[model samples]
Target chain A: MLSLEYLQECYGFNHSKWKINGEILDTEKGVKRLTNWTEEKRVRWHVQWRDQLAEKTGCLTNRMIQTIHGERIILSDAGWVTLHDEVTSLFSYKNRENEIGAFFGRYFSLGMQDVDTEINDPYANNKLKIYLQQSFLTKNSTEEMRFLEGIRRESRLRYNKAKEIKEKAGGKQEPIVAPIRSLDQGKVVYGQFYWTNLKGRPEKGYGSLRNVLTEWLQRYGQTSLFSLLNEIDKEFSLKGYHGKNLLAECLTPWEFLEYVMKTRDVHEKDELLVWKEKLTYQWEASRLLVKALGEWLDVAQEKVTV
Target chain B: MTYEQPSSLAFSIKESVWLREGEEIDELLSLALEPDISIREADDQVFIRGSLLLFGEYKPKEQDSNSNSYSDQISFRSVEEVTMSDDGIGMIRHSFPLDVTIPREKINRLEDLYVTVDAFDYELPGKGCIELEANVSVSGIKHERTEEPEDTYDEQQDEESDDYYTRPQEYNDFSSEREEMNERSFHFEAVREAAADDETKDEYESRVEEIKGESKEFQNYERNAAFEQHYEEEDQYEQEENNEEPVSYNTDPEIEPEYEGETEPEPEPEPAPEPELVRSEPTVNFSPQPSPVSAVEETHELEEEGEEEAGRDQTEKSSSSKDENALYLTKMLTKGDQEEFSKLRMCIVQDGESLETIAERYNIQVSNLIRMNRLNEERVAEGQILYIPVKQTPTSKS
Candidate 1:
């Protein structure tokens, strides 16, 4: 957090006399009578500072200013300050009533622009300092874009997590209770109960592994790890299926590891190690995918989580 | 019944005939009056008797050659009749005997008892003459009678006497002496009699003496209770009076205070003993006296008791008589004092103290202080002071 005292210290200035348009000007009177200062007087002061700073630097594009905190350097063109692209995008200059004067004063006080820009000199060096300040330091547009990008990336990760889970389960067989005999083929074959039942088979079943496993998981997942793994295997047919057949394919990496622990008579330590390795590999792969996608999408990488 | 004079008149005059020129003659007549016009019904009719004078004018026919010779042919006839009828209206009919013979010369001559006709020669075809007859007849009528009112003074006097006798005579003496003596004694006797029987007077007196001692002891025990109750009651009365007074006073601020706290109980006991003393001593003095004197003495005792009770009541009321006045004066004084004090405090604070410090010292909110002084909170400077109200601990949150 920026403390009020620090901001005050950084911006504080002492009243002083200076020469403007070949005339001595009192800083106190200038500040006090700022409302009464004519446009001519302001322009005259601007030109005086422009010539004095330009004579010392011998370059108009880049100039240094003295501020309360330290010396700041900026780019300018002629005497007009230039803003950075990010900063310019954050705050529009079109509708600003006092854009030039406010930008000059702000940059001048902060010492982030050349003194030639503060004097309103039309020089390339002064323009360079204005451009840099407007594009980079003056407005915090990049931070805002990063914040929005983080939100978008987080939503994408959630979407992908759900999508991955969906794809892993896409080719699994629903379940079959009895063999289906096709009238044209004269043979019995394992098929989903819904298809057999629709074909008017006599032994159509009312319950399936998916329904039972989902019910069991919903009831016992929080209390027992063994039941949770059992339900997962039964629902996915992970223990019974392997290879690339569409009706009964092997479980995806995460699901297969879960299946091995449920079906094999393994010690608890072995199952944990298996689960830990699979999870670590899945996490690493997910992180790399997220990082590459995030960059391509111009989004933040903080979105992807397990 | 009251009678008012008739303020309206109704009358009509009808001629007996349309007279022809030659048949005109002098007529002697007696009028026939309708029946039922008698003295008993006299109020129904009005009578005006007088002679009617007839004046005649003659004009000769234009077709006649003697029109210039009849210049002096005009004549006058006068007749008199006594008129009596209801509301000045009368109807008369004359009957002539058919067998009576009369000479033509006599008919042509103007007679006092013959009918006469007057005619006019005119261009119109209708009859231009009407006949008049004179006959002798006696006529009379009965009229409505006016009644005389009966006397009721004797009956009213008798009723007044009876009404006077219905009321009790003793109230006079009761009221007369009631004002002369003390009312406290009278009420005390009444209350004492109502409380204790006559045969038990001696017993009651002794019992009362015992109770007096007991009461004094009980009073010591109940002193705090009675005092608390009295104080609480007084406080409640004061608050209610405070509310009633201002509302009433605001409407009519100059109303007297004695009317406000008239029922308060301060001087009641002083007159209490007076009735007791009067009740005990008066009957003793009247025991050997005559009946009238004893009656007088009894009445005197009653009056004395009444006066004593009244005096005690008045004395009791006298103390609180000033209470309302005092309260009113105090209320006025306090209001004025508060306003003046607030003004002075505002001046003092405005001279140099900060509003926040003043608000803190007075235990009021800074916002309230600013509002009271009508100052802007953000722009207020040091030593730009404001009014600090004397804060009261709130009794309840609204």
Candidate 2:
């Protein structure tokens, strides 16, 4: 029942300690701290994001997945996943290869855990995914793809430049730029949406994206990945009632795919399977693109082999 | 002796008339003839015409001796005829009657008797007057006339009557008595004036002499007392100045005690005891001879002792300086001798002596000690050592 304006005025929209797959993602810098904010402002921002998600979808629920190896798995209402296996998993899901597969395979095999069965209908996940895919295509899919592509291009450039710098310096220093994935696409899409809606004029879009990212990093990115992932789990449960419908509606297949990519990385062979699951209308649009891209890549590999 | 025939009474009657046309003369006569008759006319005419009867030697039956005896037989009448004018005054007049009678004894009692008649007379413009006739009677009884002595007695009585009319002799006596009283009063006043003059002179002389003597005596007494007081004051002033100099000098020893005897005796006795220290330390071997330099040093030392005593007194009197002196001595001893100073320090530390008490005993300033030791004066610790200055004695200058 809390309006977005009321939430924004009272709780604000800034995130605190964002995490992906149990690892903390670095925002840029100069982010305002949640502790520095009044409790009303903190709660308001939380409620705002919660409401936004709820407006798109039904009530969002959260589940904590604990692996047998003492790993933590946090699943969002849209089945976006985070794992706390290592600090590197917060930025890049490829680092948590074993833990990610264990969580996904367990969920697929067990169908629903006892904790998840207690809070939600056992059959709600399949319906929820379908709802998320429809909403993404209708409302957020194109924007999500655009945002993910921009972020991917930017991250690739940054990684290449960092790698080049390290090579030229002849140092063993790791690259400073984090790897990109489609899971970051959700945040990028929302960030760009916020930029356009909150900060952008018609004359200037994405004018303050860097500043926004910088502030997010400094304020909410200081905590460890495990704590951040736990906090995101709590945020999903707390925001379930408010932003469930909104998120259910706005989380399209592209957004879900982006969420999954940023949250979980796949090998090249499994990429098509991930695309097939996310894109609901295989005959309509994304299946063609996927097939064409797969054929072009096969041809290129064959050329390289020859 | 033939009594002269007493003359018969000759009586006459007079009538005076004024006819106013038929006035009867007989009526006038008839009226005149009445007994005890008297006729009067309007024109101032009077007539007496009454019978006089002779009664030779006959006394009347009812006659009393106290009454007068006289012949009563006489008659006179007179009538005057006058022409009355219109104013009723008579212009022309005629007398008509007269009567007379004589008794056997001549009546000689009448001397200057006169009868007067008054009548109304209009023409005369005033009341009328009477005409009088004089008569003299003589008796033939006296052959020789003699003066009686009784008459002379009467004449003398009459002359003595003038004396009654004048003032009596007692008036002169009263006047003289008044004059004498006045004289006595004058004499009394003069005597009182003289007595007052004598009293004033005597009082003025005695007062002048008394004042003069008292003034001289007062001047002498005042001069003697003033002289005595002047000498006493001078002596007292000099003694006070002398006393004050020593007290003030003792108060501030920067002004040295010039009186050697007063200051030296106490310190000399005390300093004599310190010689045992010199004797006991024979190895130190300080010279025993009291050289001139030693004397000078001793005097300086004595002066220092005096100054220190003064300072001690000041410190004792003043609460502020007690600590200062202790600190000063502690500093001095510490600066000069470290081991001995440390022993003193140990004493202070062990004895738990207060800074002020230590200051007084050591003859040093407490502040200086605190500064040297780098200790807070307010919080001096136990086991802190303080140095004490040795006080030296004074010697005789001679």
Candidate 3:
């Protein structure tokens, strides 16, 4: 519901560029423009603005950018709010069939080959349009781990704050849990310049929530601390995932995980005997999750409308 | 029994087809065309699948005007030939797939097809795909199967020879005035409105017919004419003679052919085309851009000639009157005829020969004539020399 007028007047987002990415320049809605070569000179001002929000909140967060009122504007200062856990399992090297197979899900689409591959081949000698920079592959790449740790603490704190506010108001209002909406129609191939966590940020920021979660597991070591509560069964079921008994009312990610790990007893004859593997990190998994939590908020509409 | 005379017909049609146009501003820098062609014949329909593989090294344009910009374009194109089945319905729908329903009735074959890039450029300044507009010319050729009487061979040949001259859009700038001039009198319409004056319709048409026949003969005679003509001649520049009596095109051209006796065995020079900038090599020692005369004033001059012709000579068929007929037809040359005439000429600019006199003789722009030969002076003394681009004729070519 935030208006560009509010963005300009209040936040001083006066820059003509980033505030206009995916903007419907023509009066007729038929033409959609992507300023593919804009090089982030204009949009960086807005991203820097988001950095200020992070500075004030003391929590690093990314904006969910989209088009409304025929202009591309940030909907929320935080794109990732509600955390998901299974996405980390998907990114695990143990789960994948091949060394590079883990990168093939929603995140890995089209990308330029390595610089050497491009130099040898006559046709494609240009730098990649979308891919993680080689610098991320270096041995001491702990920046990703730091990013995940920051988000885990931030989400746990936010969930606790939302619960406190709800309890204080006698449970009359909904809690603050931000879910994700797919960027570029859930496409990662040739992702345009606009699909970034912030201006000049790598496209890894805009990968599918599952893909980004997997990336965290590879770089930050396996963790399930960020999974939101889901429907998990007692003593685990044959489905391996006990999502049936996962979500508990008004609890944060790691809080719900700790509750499940403690309640589910180890029975020798249980068909889902391997449920302990997911809880290996005990109460310290730190992955992100996203779902249609907005559906839960509109409880009346969901019950009557199909 | 009717004898079938071979009819040469070329069909020209325009169709808008999608072309593969892209621009990689940061990568490979050149433009080349590669095509994948598929020809399929299915129940009364021919489907042609065509994909163009456009690849090239793209050198970024020089940002500064003072720098060299020699690598502007690379001449790269791919042409493919595929057999298409003609449907019974003569209407063909040609798409990028080249999927078309070609009428099988009259078309003997798709003799030749060529595509020209009519217009192409970048629509956006910064980063965007290139916009290319190409004109695809598909010539569906058919032959006339009608039989001719043996005695009428000469008459039929005259009529059949006209296909050599009917071309599209190559006219002098002033030729646009023809449509307006045609409204003044229908008789002028029959003249080469392209070259038409206030002459009688019969006289003009007859003259155009003569030019067509002569041009066809010249093309046949000088197939390799462009390669062999190497003659050394001094520069012959003449000053403008706008002050003198306007030269009439009604002079007996056969009288001018007396000079042909001197260069009888030399190779005939073909017409110099305009926009010679596109060609790699210059054809003429000095290339003068040809210009047709303005109609309003030229028409008035022609009306005077027409009256003089009517008073002095009759349109008789005697051998004596053939020169008059030649003179009448020489003025109404078709597009191809005009091209045949733009050959190199070394005119010893005599005392009376002025700029207009030589320009009218060559049928080229007086300004361009001056620029091409680099005419240095305003006045022409005896033997001051000029390169008059006289129209090549049977007599002139040797």
Candidate 4:
């Protein structure tokens, strides 16, 4: 799936045009809209806010160290230490009762081994394929296996949606070194949920995934994503699936792979396969965040009041 | 030279996501579908990479208000042979196979698919399937070359070539031509002086000898008188001026000789007979410039230049102001260069006024207005703005 990050940054709703049509969903307080802003003013605010969001989240990658000419480096040593530590700690658990739990735990650990050439660690592009032949991917047998499959199936759908958003924004996902099946999040699930300020919370006012991301960035400014990525070294961002051209400005997921390989100090292809689970979890986590934010703040249209 | 060109493919592909046989759709966590296509030329093959981007909130039959959607991507890769243009300019097309379906059989794929515009996502409230449209285009693009290559310009060769002109020649030719023109007046003066009275050689010699003898006697007498006065006044002036500082000598005192030249004793030499004018065809240019050969002759020969100039002056003096204007215009045209001292004046057409009439009133050529304003009609309507050249008649040069 693609990252809707660029679109989120570029597009914005005309919130200044929003009128208070009905009472706020949770309270009797009527929806308040400050519509004194002109289109230019609103757009300016959105662009600036998006920039702030990108600064906090989009600036860092596990590939290489980026220089800002300011005091802040793109990725810091402290951030890398945190990310490596967190991934190894959180992703190294044994599978629990959940059918796909073991698979998730084994793949997500940041301490991945060097992959050999002869082994299979599918190159990570945005596109992910599921090999149902793997017992963990298909829902069969017990109810637990079925639950794992359902989560994966949903994750896959979300991943594609994110991918579409990425492509629409005139970009592609970075090459990742993992299995297609690993992209599904049945293995590791981070239970963090947030609410959006959109008109229809549970129903259809949810704007496009891109719209949601943009709203999220507009509201929170990537602070959550920053925390999610767990920071990395600036030097770490310099390495990725991208060719020698080092643009630290572009934060790609392949930077995760680079971080994994380097920190683990492994080059074996099979070792890369173990990462599918963790990378998949990461992708799912980001998608959920984007979706959550998209729903809460999608103010593009007028919806029926509760 | 392989230059990248961007071409867009406008195609529509449609697919549907069918809910299970007896399930009502409700709320989706996320709903998204994006169409994507990529171009890759590798390993002696050109392939198109296509994928479907699907994610978020899926409510198939509206059974529940807060249901979640599946998130994943469907991808395909293939290549179809496309005809390339000879000049390599048009039609570098590559098509790849694409297939998409929901994993849970919540959506059923359509058979005999003839759908285009495959990018759309919406709920099928009572319906079993979520129909999606996929329509995306591919465009070929070439990266811009950053640095501009230097042009292969050769100045020396351009100078030696006949089809070119250089700036240094303009400077040199302009100065020398101006000097040559100035010499024409000098030559005219010489010619005018030569055309004076004639006398025999014997008479001229006798007259010169007589004047020389008289001049010698007059000079000797004047010098002897001056020398005596200087000696006598030296002692008196030395003490009187020595104390006051040496008196500066008055240099080159003017002497006025009486006008006795009414009848000169020295006979003047005879003027040369006027040369017969040779008649030659004048080379005319399609434009107003005079032929180079005739121009050169006019500048070099004083008599010819004088004759031509005299005729021109007489014609100018006799002409009326109107005719003078015409002459001035002709001269201006022949010069082929004029500065725009005034702007191109705009005029509005009045009712019942035609282009020809307007031009006549302004004393300007109708064709000029047409060419300047790029008009196709010979007539203009009232209040229509027309841009005409300024009709500023040049004042006569002093």
Assess each prediction's global lDDT (C-alpha) against the native.
0.22, 0.22, 0.25, 0.25
| lDDT for each residue of candidate 4 in B88-206, tens digit (9 for 90 to 100) | 11121112223221111111121211213324545442344443333343222111111112212233442332122221211221221211111110000000111111321233234
**i-RMS, every candidate?**
73.1, 99.9, 30.3, 18.5
- DockQ values, each candidate: 0.00, 0.00, 0.02, 0.01
> Model 2 residue B390 lDDT?
21
Q: Is the docking of candidate 2 incorrect, acceptable, medium or high quality?
A: incorrect
lDDT, candidate 2, equals 0.22
Considering the two chains of model 4, state its CAPRI-style docking category. incorrect
How much DockQ does model 4 earn? Answer: 0.01
**Per-candidate TM-score against the hidden true structure:** 0.12, 0.11, 0.20, 0.16
Which regions of candidate 1 are displaced past 4 Å? Answer: A1-207, A214-306, B1-368, B371-374, B377-390, B394-398
Residue A257 of candidate 1: its Cα lDDT?
A: 28
Model 4 residue runs over 4 Å out of place are A1-127, A132-140, A172-288, A292-306, B1-125, B128-398
The deviation in Å at residue A232 for candidate 3 is 26
* Candidate 1, position A15, lDDT: 55
The C-alpha RMSD of each candidate to the native structure, in angstroms, is 55.9, 77.1, 28.8, 40.1
Which portions of model 2 show Cα errors greater than 4 Å?
A1-89, A94-99, A110-306, B1-398
Better of 1 and 4 by lDDT: 4
